[model samples]
Structures are given as C-alpha cells and as structure tokens.
Target: MATGWAGDNAVQDQIDATVEDAVKRARSQLNQGPSLTHCEECAAPIPTARRQAVPGVRLCVGCQEVRDQQAAFSGYNRRGSKDSQLR
Candidate 1:
C-alpha cells in the first residue's frame, strides 16, 4: 500500500518516467546529418571504418572516448525513498 497521497502504482510510474527520460537523453546525444571526415574537436582524421559503422559520427575514437567520459547524468532525484536520498 502506498503511504501519504501516492497511489498504489506511484512507485512504478516514477520508475518508468525516469527510464523514459534516460532513453530520451541517450537518443538526443546521437549525432545527426552526414559523418565528418575529420574530428570536430581535435581535427584528427576520422577512419572510414568508424564513419561507416556510426553514421553521422563527428569525432575520432579518442575524442569520442574523452567526450563520453566527460558526460554527466542528471542529478534529479525521482525516487524520494530514504535509501535513494542517502546516495
């Protein structure tokens, strides 16, 4: 049973919404249009194999790896559970 004013399915609904947001975020990060022959950030040559494998790739493997490492996740706390707040 849900406590307070939340419905029985409120927890599940919140989980679903959070998952949907993550999926949308991932999709938005995908590059569009034609793949560039050179990396946009480092100007390094983009290999034909990478360009063919990933359509519309803009950065070389090294640059892409760095960019991925720099990516941050949203800090929004959808779950108000005590355990979640501890983290």
Candidate 2:
C-alpha cells in the first residue's frame, strides 16, 4: 500500500490532479463569453452541432483535435518540488 518516494497512490494522485486542472481550465474558458460561430484562427465556420455539443468550443473539430493531441503529448514534472527546482 506504500509507494516509497513516489508516495502512496502517486499515480492516481497525478491523474486526479491533471483531470482537475483540465476541468478548471475548461470552465474558466466557458466563463469568458459565448462561443463564436467560426474558428478565430481560421475563417472556417464552426458547425452548429459542435457549438451545441461543447459549451465553449473556440476551435473547429480539426483544430480542436490538434490541440488535444498536443496537450496530451506535453509533459509536466508532477513530482518536482521546490527543493528539486533549487537543485
């Protein structure tokens, strides 16, 4: 039941933290105002289905997919501490 230096339930804790951060980020974006009917980056029109499906989608399906993929690949040092940073 102990995970030593990693701490107990370290993996689960990291996952929960990531999910919570993501949810908070998404919610903040929603509070910014209504979603536009078109992608800001591109002139492409945002489909009605997408706007209704996602509360505050700023990008179209294609752009959203790319952003999601990039986010998933980005890494964060969850185990890093202030002491570690100093070193």
Candidate 3:
C-alpha cells in the first residue's frame, strides 16, 4: 500500500534503493589486492591479526579508531525533506 504521494511501491522502492546504496558503499570499501603491512595514516605497524581479519587493511587500530570517530561526526541526514530544509 502506498503511504504517501509517490505510489504503491514507493516505500518498497525507497527500501530497495537504500539497501542497494549500502551494498555499493560496502563493496567500495573492500580491498582489491594485498593488505598493507603498515598504517597509511600514522605509519604504524599494522598487526598481523588485523591484516588477516580485514584483508587489505591499511590503518592500524588506533588510527582506524580515530578515522572512524571523524567519520561519525561528518555524517548528514540524507533523508531530510524540503520542508525541513527551509527551516
């Protein structure tokens, strides 16, 4: 059932789009070749366990944590409406 002005499949379409976007984003993050032995950011040695776990890991644990924190703060509300934008 359509809940809004779009159509009967609008909600399902949105859901499918969201899932597709997430899958694309995740696939983009995968390493293409060999894992780096050192952290690219801090030049620290990446642990063997991490390299084995992540496959093509770049940054060490500490640098990766910092990068993750920075990313967390940079996110935006992608679903914001035009009405909300005006406010």
Candidate 4:
C-alpha cells in the first residue's frame, strides 16, 4: 500500500532500476576491446586468472575493487520516462 508519499512499489521500482543499470554497465564492460596486461592505476600485473574470469578487464583486482566501489556510488539518471518528468 502507498504511504505518506510514494507508494510501496516506488521502492521496488528503484531496486529494479538499479539492477538494470548494473546489468547495462556489466554488458558494456564485457564488450570492451581488450584487457590490459598491466593495471592502469598501480601498474601491477593483471593476473591471467582475473583476465579469463572477467572478459575485457583492464584493472587489477585491487584497482578493480576501488573502481567498482566508485562506480556504485555514482548514482544513475533514471528519468527517461514521461511520468517521471511530470513530477
């Protein structure tokens, strides 16, 4: 049921949007050209295991973690619908 403001489904919609964004990002990253032998952040060697596990990976494990965290914090602009604009 709706509460004081947005309905209960509003939170569900936000979750769905977040998942969609994550999937889209993962797909684009997978389609990247190639993996780099060395990490761009610390110049550490990118292990073969990581390269094989994550296709088109560019950063080392440590660097990748940091980058991923940064990306997660950078919220998406999920406002393409006309209904959203009406608000």
Candidate 5:
C-alpha cells in the first residue's frame, strides 16, 4: 500500500532496503580480529570488564562516549528532494 505514486511494494521495498543497509553497517563495525587492550583514540587503558563485555572493543568508555555523541549529531537525510526523487 504505497501512499505515493510508487507501486504497492514501494514502501515495503524501502523498508527492506533500510533494514539491509543497517545490517551491512553493523556487520562492517564487527571486529574481525583480536580486541585491543588500549583505547585506539586516546591510548587509555581499556578495562578488562569492558573488553570482556564487548568483544573487539576499540575505545574506552570516555572516548566511546564522545564518538557516540559525534555520531548522534551526524544527521541523515532520508527524504530526497523532488527533483532527485524524480531521477
């Protein structure tokens, strides 16, 4: 039930595409090798608890928090302009 000019499966297709993109992003972030003992950004000692809790943990709590904050501010434009959509 697409509400726009697109076909019935348009909305479902968009949803599926979004989910696939999220999965790909998550998989890319997954650590493929050993976890670092120190924070890569600040060179601070990464706690054993954190390392154990999150396998492949790269940054410490503080650095990770800052990184998360930066990520939060990076907005995404899901809706493209009419001209772009027409293409």
Candidate 6:
C-alpha cells in the first residue's frame, strides 16, 4: 500500500471524485421548468404520461430510443488506462 508521494487512499479519492463529477454533470443536463409537449427532434406529439413521468421530456419515445442507441460510454478512466493525464 506504499504509494510513495501519494496517500494510501488517493486513488480511491480520485475515483470517487470522478463519479461525483459525472453524476453532477448528468443531473445538470436534466431539463427544468415545463416539459415540452412535442418531440424536439421529430416534431411528434409527446404523450401526457411520458411528459409527467420524465418531468422535462423533450423527445418522443421513438426519437429517444434512437438517441439512446447512438449514445456511447461516458465515464471516468477504466481498464487501467490514462489519457493525457500523466504527460
């Protein structure tokens, strides 16, 4: 557990901070105020149940499904790889 210059829990601290940052970022992306009545992407009518359930629902079910498919990994470093951090 000898981490030389770094504390024993430094690695865990960094991981926790990364998770916290990701959560804050995700929450910040949530829409506030009134939910849109129509899908912003395809101009389709967003259902009342969906709107009530999602709070700030913007996209209709179909468009949202497509978007969810296109989305990719968005998280902290994993599999023991660093990206431009130790340069």
Off by over 4 Å in 4: 1-26, 29-31, 74-87
C-alpha lDDT of all candidate models, in order = 0.91, 0.79, 0.85, 0.82, 0.87, 0.87
Error of 1 at 68 (Å): 2.0
Best by TM-score: 6
Lowest summed-lDDT stretch of 10 residues in model 6?
Answer: 78-87
Model 4 scores a TM of 0.52
| CA lDDT, candidate 6, residue 13 | 100
Candidate 1 on 1-87: residue-level lDDT in tens?
A: 746698889899999999999999989978898999999999999999999999999999999898777775556887979999888
Clashing pairs counted in every model: 0, 0, 1, 0, 0, 0
Task: Give me the overall lDDT of model 4.
Answer: 0.82
- Candidate 6 — number of clashing residue pairs? 0
Please, what are the lDDT tens digits per residue for candidate 4 over residues 10-78?
999999999999999877756376888898889999999988877777789898788788878845556
Better of 3 and 5 by lDDT: 5
Query: 1-87, model 3: which lDDT tens digit per residue?
Result: 755477779799999999999999989987777889988898989889989999778889999898889878844655579876555
- Tens digits of per-residue lDDT, candidate 6, 13-67, equal 9999999999999999987888899899999999899999999888999998888
Residue 5 C-alpha lDDT in model 5: 85
Best by lDDT: 1
Residue-pair clashes, model 3:
1
C-alpha lDDT (0 to 100) for residue 46 of candidate 5: 94
What lDDT tens digits, residue by residue, belong to model 5 across residues 33-80? 667999999999998999988888999999989988988884555567
> What ranges in model 1 sit over 4 Å off?
1-4, 72-87
State the local distance difference test value for candidate 6.
Answer: 0.87
Q: Estimate each model's TM-score.
A: 0.68, 0.53, 0.69, 0.52, 0.65, 0.71
Candidate 6, residue 33: how far the Cα is off, in Å: 1.9
By TM-score, the candidates rank as: 6, 3, 1, 5, 2, 4
In candidate 1, residue 50 scores what lDDT?
A: 94
After the best TM-score superposition of candidate 4, give how far the Cα of residue 78 lies from its true spot, in angstroms.
9.2
